[model samples]
Target chain A: MLSRPDFHALIKENRVHSSLYYDERVFQEELENIWYKTWVYVGHVSEVPKKNDYVTKAIGPTPILMVHDRHGNISLLQNKCPHRGNQLCAYQKGNRTSFTCPYHAWTFANSGELVGLAFPDGYEGVDKSEFSLGKVPRIAIYRGLVFGSFAKEGPSLEEHLGDAKRALDQMLDNSPEGELELTAGFLQHRTKANWKFVLENETDGYHPGSVHGSIFQVASSPVPALYKPESLALTRDYGNGHTEFDLRPQWRHVGKPMYWFNTTAEKLPLYTEAMKKAYGEQRSQEIMIDGSPHIMIFPNLFIAEIQMFVIQPVSVNETIQHVTALQFKGAPDFNRRLRQQTMGSVGPAGFLLADDTEMYERNHRGALINNPEWIVLTRGEKRETRDEDGHRIGHSTDEVTQRGIWRHYLKLMTEQA
Target chain B: MIDENEIDPSIAEPVALSPEQELMLRRIEQFLYYEARLQDLHAYDAWESLWTDDAIYWIPANGENPDPETQMSYVYDNRSRIGVRIKQLKTGKRHTQTPRSQLARIISNIEFIAQNGDEFEVRANAFIYEDSLRGETTWAARNEYRLRLVDNKLKLVRKKVVLVNNNKPIYTLSFLV
Candidate 1:
């Protein structure tokens, strides 16, 4: 293990060594400390909608089977049979009352409690009751989203989320019923990139203009080349490794802006209009257009309410992004079709996302180059910083948010739990 | 083989083709075939013009449901969304279009299901093959089309595609199916 001084010295410079990306030692340490200790998102509560419904997900290197129990509670357990360490639950998702191991006929309930063993005579003195599928150390839910932590003790889920919960609230509040549910299915993609690259890409406003230039040109006519600095909202160094980019209404004119605001300033009437009527004009406007851009909940969650992109990281470098084209559950069919058309473009295979993924792959490959010692995130370095709700603001094109992520990453990697 | 007139209604219906109805059906078939050909040939601009200003395109998420509002969908595009996509495809900076996607489509079972004045509904079956950096992916589906005659020209009002494997994991769907 590297000494504390050496680790602190490397992190203090705010630049990470390239070896960290490919090193097995660093990967193992992150699994032990970061992945296991932090409250990691373990799929959404809406995924396993019914009793016995289950989906397989990975937390770091560990494969976890997430299931909905009889009482509608979510449980995360090791996807391994204790009897012979055989891999259980081969299917990605299904409704099963019990999982019977193929090797020895060991049965486990949907709750992951071992209920049966094939041979009782073989273990004459050994107790079968002592053996059960290993459960995650901590499981918690916040506003219907489920999360799990392998650590025995740490900050509560709410405490760990900190101000990030506000983003979650805004997402759920957008729904007419004041609750957001996962769409029927998800779009899964396997990309060659570090997991952090995925998180950084989601909130990195600076890249949309350059990296996705082809998409912008193809999607927009007489492409608007002017970059209005005032229209972009940049905030860096949010507590607990969080960063947010709030694009101004003007910035929405980039390619095809969301229906929330159009060229005529006509806002798409939302499902929560009653709340708007009750709150009056000022509060209603704030709630309606308070923040339209993407918000990154540090570590792994990227919530893009405008385009309907919800990304969940599966590994240190691999991510499983679930893109849902959301529509008001009770809305009219016409309105729903309209919403789907606008929202569907953000999926993994859509035109916009195709370009975005290409850039992500390029970045991943570029980072692996032998020459460069640091990936410069020094855009808009001289911009003034303004504070708002524990966030520091910079130009929309600034790399301040990326720096914020790096700072938090250093803190997590260097901190002693 | 049984005679055409002796066929059962449940198994098959009388193949009727009226002059005007035949013309309309032919136009609809050409519209769908041309649209598919454009996408297959990577002619995005030509493919985009098949829709009217208010045309709606949908690929329903649930295999059994015809409604797209309550259930999710894979691809839904309108005028603005389609315009944005066209722009993205034409943009020189798109890296995913590096090698560009090569596609071929097979369309069959063209028939006019319903008609009312200048408005008509047509249905067909399609099989699309797409090859790109990710690899080649095949999609087979049935399609329902609603068209309206505006200014003496056929324009799409709605196009609903029902994929046989609608519930399966979709590979990259970078272009129109």
Candidate 2:
């Protein structure tokens, strides 16, 4: 085990030790301190909308089942059966009143109650209450998105989210009904890179033009204003490792019709008309101009360009990225456009994302070099400003957001185990 | 969602090919063989030019799904997106392509699934062997091509690649499958 001082030495304000990415000891420390303790996005309530609907997902190393109970409450249960530690839920998703373990025929209710056991007479003195599938320590939901924390106590999900709530609201408020769904299935990509690489790259503004230059050059549509830093988009560190690439305040006053940002009145006639009717013209205009803020919800969640990316660390150098393109429940045309836009940039073969995967692997390889002790995180330190919400806002071309992430990471990683 | 009306009526079902159609099959097999060669050689421009102006190159995620608008896909590109992708590959700045993929593929089981006026739906299976800095990836796929003969030259209107492991978590699909 690394001492607290050793953990503290691994991170600094302008640079972090490369061992943070390559060291198995550091990786194990993260799994225990960060992954198990923090609030991690497990699944959305929309996934299991009705009674008995369930899906098996992983929050770090623990496999869990997110199921809607008979009372319509969503519960997170360890997918492992209490009997003999067998995996209980084998399928990815299904509707079932009870799950029967294939190995021991131990039956668990949708609510995670141990209702049946093979040869109960042989284990007459066993307490059924003690053998129920273990429940996750806590679960929190915001705007239909569910998050699970393995720690018995910590800050509430709301506190952890901080000013990142605005981005979630934007995602939900884009729909007239103020709801979004994951009707569109996920695009899963397993890459040979550290989980932190995905977290940093998602909010990194310095790489778009260089890393995704080919995509930018080839897009027939007008480039997204966020990609053009001259437009003055801000990368804000909301603390708690949550940060957002804010497009709203920058483009709020751009007073011209821009098609990519959806400000043009004639660009999407049917969808625009629907939005206007549902949200009124003024609010519709705001939603359009604000565009969608690229958000990193610390540790695991990422909402960028209309897709939700959940980073799952498989090993020291392996990460599985699950991306779900969201849909507006009431707006089919708008949802279709969102899906198209998201598909263009994310997923396994996305023109923009495929390049990023390559970069992550290469970056991981480079971090393995023992000579380079530190990876630079300094970019726009001098230009930092505090927004009204007390979040640190930096230039779009800066690495301020990464610094924010490491601050919380260093704090969490160094805490007494 | 793909407009069902926009889809060629012939691909709606399988049909028998006539003698002349059978001859066209021989040419298609040759076309597919060289198309694979162009990709293996990293001749992106030549490979891209093989497509018609209104082409749809798709690799659906989570099994075969007809609706690209609502369903996720590995690669769902229109002609413009395809152009941008090829442009990126050509820039030689895409770091992932550095020491570009050493790829070779075997195309087999070519058959005419259906035919309509001036259009044909062809299906084939392939085993693509790829090697890069990361490691080797063996990709086996069911390749479905929507072709049109323009001025006696075959033009690709669509290429739908269905990988055997379509629903699983995949590594970087930087190269064409």
Candidate 3:
């Protein structure tokens, strides 16, 4: 029997034990207590735009598929064939009228209705409803992103999203049509690091200067400026393990819009015109200045400004990231720029991201070393404070987000125990 | 950003050519070898100089079916972006390339696929073996290049790298493919 360590002690106010990155038992418990029990993001609704469109993904080790059925409903279906344990749909993404298991030829409608099976004479007494594909107990959609939970009950998606909903709101409002198209394919990156490294790195605003100074030096980036102490950009702890690098203050400092893109409205005249036409001139300007989010939703999803990331955990020391360009519908010109920028700044070969990945691998290696056994995270805790909405806000280059994430994580790991 | 309707020089079928055309191919073959050498040596400046002003260096994601305008690509650098890539490499601060990965590449099967006046299309095979602190990573790709003769010297206008495992998860593409 594995002994349990107090997660509260492991996760302190200003530091976290390095063992969290290497403990297999802890990783398994995380999958059971959090990933399986709580709502896990599966895929975006934009990914399954039409009926019969389906994409396969995994929640922890269990394979699941997201499908848009004939009834214009989006739902989650277990990818396992009820007859035996063969994988039902193997392809990454495709249009499928029905899922037919290759081993036993068990055919099911796209809506998880088991239509028939090969050699049915032997199974004439079996009930089709009982043999149909299993589904996640709960499926929720919030602002086009799909989430599935295996547990029968917990917080609703709206309640789980909580303050984090603002991030998605800002992201969607960037588009004049107030809709997004994630048709741009995924760029998957394999990492030899713990899944927690990805979550920690998402809002660790301090590392950009040290880790990504090279790329920023060459390009006229607004990121370096935001890290300055005097800069108005704030790092926020949105509670529930969600965190953000809120650059809105610096973006709005000029009292004008389009600073996030570092371009004038004149440059993207067509997009600007559409924005004004859709949401009126004043609202359009505010939306442009507010820009998109650089936020990490608890456990897996990240709305990293120009791109979106879905972090998938494999083991204690292995993880994979699915990255895609954030596309705005009815804004071809802006989408074109965003697509080109995403190619340069993300993925495995990305100028900024490659260096960060280096840190991820190195961080894992460092954690393995027998040391003080703790990773010091005492960056800006002294200056951190809460806002009117109860969000813990700190300097852009602060560790308040880290502390907040650990706080929420401690609550989940202990309460559910 | 490729046009599906038009005949792409890089992917065209190879045909038997005249002896005179073979001589022209020999010169282009030499340029390919020279280009490969610079990449292996991490010669950023010299390698960058091989491009024309209106050049494109692209690496298509998902095996080249969908165009870059529709589906995302690994790299879709147009002239200036290519310059930024090289500039970042030279900055001595790219942690991914700080202790740059030692690379050795082999280019083979030079196919003279198409010709259009001063422009020529060539297809070749490349296997790049990289030895880094992390471990060894081998990258294999089909190199499709569109070369233009500027002042009687071959200059790269476009180079498309189509990796075999584009559809699958890739470990590290921090270095040149």
Highest lDDT model number: 3
- TM-score for candidate 2, residues paired by index: 0.92
Off by over 4 Å in 3: B1-13
The reply for model 2, stretches above 4 Å from the true place, is A1-5, A220-229, A256-263, B1-22
Tell me model 1's lDDT, rounded to 2 decimals. 0.66
Question: What docking grade does candidate 1 earn?
Answer: incorrect
Task: List each candidate's DockQ score.
Answer: 0.22, 0.44, 0.49
> What is the C-alpha interface RMSD of model 2?
6.1
lDDT of 1 by residue, A337-395 (tens): 43554445555456566667766666667767878756666676577486766476677
lDDT of 3 by residue, A1-417 (tens): 998767987998999999989999889778888888888888889988888888877786677788898778997899988889898877777877898999989999988989987988887688888887898989998878899888898889888889889889999999998888898889888888898898999999898888988988999967788887788989999888899999888988866677788777888889999999999989999999888999999989999888999989888898888899999988999998898889998888888778888889999999999877999999988888988998999999999988888888888888953
TM-score of each: 0.75, 0.92, 0.96
TM-score of chain B of each: 0.84, 0.90, 0.90
Question: What value does DockQ give for candidate 2?
Answer: 0.44
Ranking by lDDT: 3, 2, 1
What lDDT tens digits, residue by residue, belong to model 3 across residues B73-156?
888899999999999999899888879999998989989988899999988999989988678988889888999999999999
- Name the lDDT value of residue A46 in candidate 2: 84
Looking at model 3, residue A337 earns an lDDT score of 88
Q: How many backbone clashes does every candidate have?
A: 10, 0, 0
